[model samples]
Target: MANEKITEEEVESISSFARISLDDDEIEDLVPQLNEILDYFDKIDEADTEGVEPLFGVHGKKNVFRDDDVGESMSQETALQNAEKTEDGYFKSPRVRD
Candidate 1:
């Protein structure tokens, strides 16, 4: 198996460019965690992929083959009759603030 050597300064430079805005204390805490994540990815890179084809999604997956059937639907007048407010046959909810 091959190994990859990563550095804290490289991670710090990336954090800076991405505007991650981590404080010194937070960056100190995240360094080890990020290194662990990268190590896991390094293991994946060591896998045998030379002859394997890359796939964007799993093969042979469909829409689960649901049966299509016509169903009843409410009329525009019946659908909006119980609202606190209605305009042009549509329900009007309270205005939102932020």
Candidate 2:
């Protein structure tokens, strides 16, 4: 792990790839932190994983969705009955984004 080194150039390249800009101070601070992270990975690589099955996910791949069926849907009037604001039988709200 001591042999692991994170160069400023590599840090600059990584920041550029992420579409973010970092000044000299930030890059200097980040180099040691990045090396520490790599050291942690080196420690993790030392773990004994013998006879351990690879984990994909805790949940299985089986479908858990309910079957879709045609049923009596709510009418427009019924849907908008409790709304504080409605326009042409539709629920109206403030714009979410520009």
Candidate 3:
């Protein structure tokens, strides 16, 4: 067999750190799959990116939010008009805990 990039012991350690319970069969299966994923990352490392500018985000627009201008404020009577239950200018709800 070719050189094993990830051993069974390493898989056990990773599963323990991730708080995951893995049987012997699952650990055996994960060793090869994790090594394959690492190999793909190795291939990606070989890519040429000398002159390429780092892209922070896909969106072209920066700070697309409207101005936070204060407008006309609603009266307290108008705000509590549609409430099913109101107590002293605030909405009242059922008791959450004993």
Candidate 4:
């Protein structure tokens, strides 16, 4: 990245590692696009955010947990009524191999 000159050997090794097959034409086309993307990230690294607080939400956050409360749960009859399949008081679905 110092000179933005990634060698053909490096490119070949990366391609092999990723198990990707790219002909000479594709590598020629990707060289500048990859270089441009890297340059953009490099430029962004120069930003000044001295006192900025890191944000997880654009809107301010509220409590992420609920207060503990004792409650009665829905009956199984009501729960299985909405299911596509129910047998022996349990939801049944297709078996997934993986």
Candidate 5:
């Protein structure tokens, strides 16, 4: 890919999409930094990775599966003992939506 430079307008547009407000000085500073990051990615793109298998996990460990076992559980009173609000043996929470 060609060495494309990031423009101030593009930085403003990116900040707008990210819901962030950037001053003129911040935008000016970020242009070169973002461009440098893109240049590093371009260097990475030029690497030769032929015959390399894709790695799934960095730790090289497969997921261990165990059988689910039935366990004893606390009673409703015990569960609601520390609750601030309870109604009809259930925890009551503030209404979130109408």
Candidate 6:
């Protein structure tokens, strides 16, 4: 894996695909890091997990919640009492999209 070096052209191609611009210095720095990552993956591929079951998660957890029962509702005025802005008796929020 150490002999399998990453080329500048490959790095440039990857940067172009990712929409990131990389100078010569940055590309040189990334070559080693990327090669190291690939080497780590190669090591992982050689691991002995023949009988090991794949784990979806590390922790055994479950959701805990109260029963969803209908409750009393607040008045319109009460609901908008703390709003910074209102329009036509409703909470007015800023426009987010064109």
TM-scores of the models, in the given order? Answer: 0.43, 0.57, 0.57, 0.52, 0.59, 0.56
lDDT of 1 by residue, 1-98 (tens): 13434456766788888867767787677777777788898799999999889776697675677788889998888887778898777888888864
On residues 46-92, what C-alpha lDDT tens digit does candidate 2 reach at each position? 99999999887788766678889899999999999999999987899
Ranking by TM-score: 5, 3, 2, 6, 4, 1
Q: Please state the error at residue 90 of candidate 3 in Å.
A: 21
* Tens digits of per-residue lDDT for model 3, 1-98: 26678999998998898889999999988888888888889899999999999887798777689999999999989998999999998988899863
lDDT of 5 by residue, 58-97 (tens): 9888886787888899999999999999999999999986
Q: Give all candidates' CA lDDT scores.
A: 0.75, 0.89, 0.89, 0.82, 0.90, 0.89
Total backbone collisions for each predicted model: 0, 0, 0, 0, 0, 0
Deviating ranges (above 4 Å) for candidate 4 = 59-98
Model 4: per-residue Cα lDDT over 1-98, one tens digit each: 46766666667788988889989988877777777787888799899979989787877866677879989999999989999998899999999863
Poorly placed runs, candidate 1 (over 4 Å)? 1-6, 59-98
Looking at model 5, report the run of 10 residues with the lowest lDDT sum.
Answer: 1-10
lDDT tens digits, residue span 1-98, model 6: 44756888999998998889999999988888899998889899999999999876667555657899999999999999999999999999999863
TM-score of 5: 0.59
Where does model 6 exceed 4 Å of error?
A: 61-98
| Top TM-score model | 5
> What local lDDT does model 4 show for residue 20?
91
Q: Best candidate, lDDT-wise?
A: 5
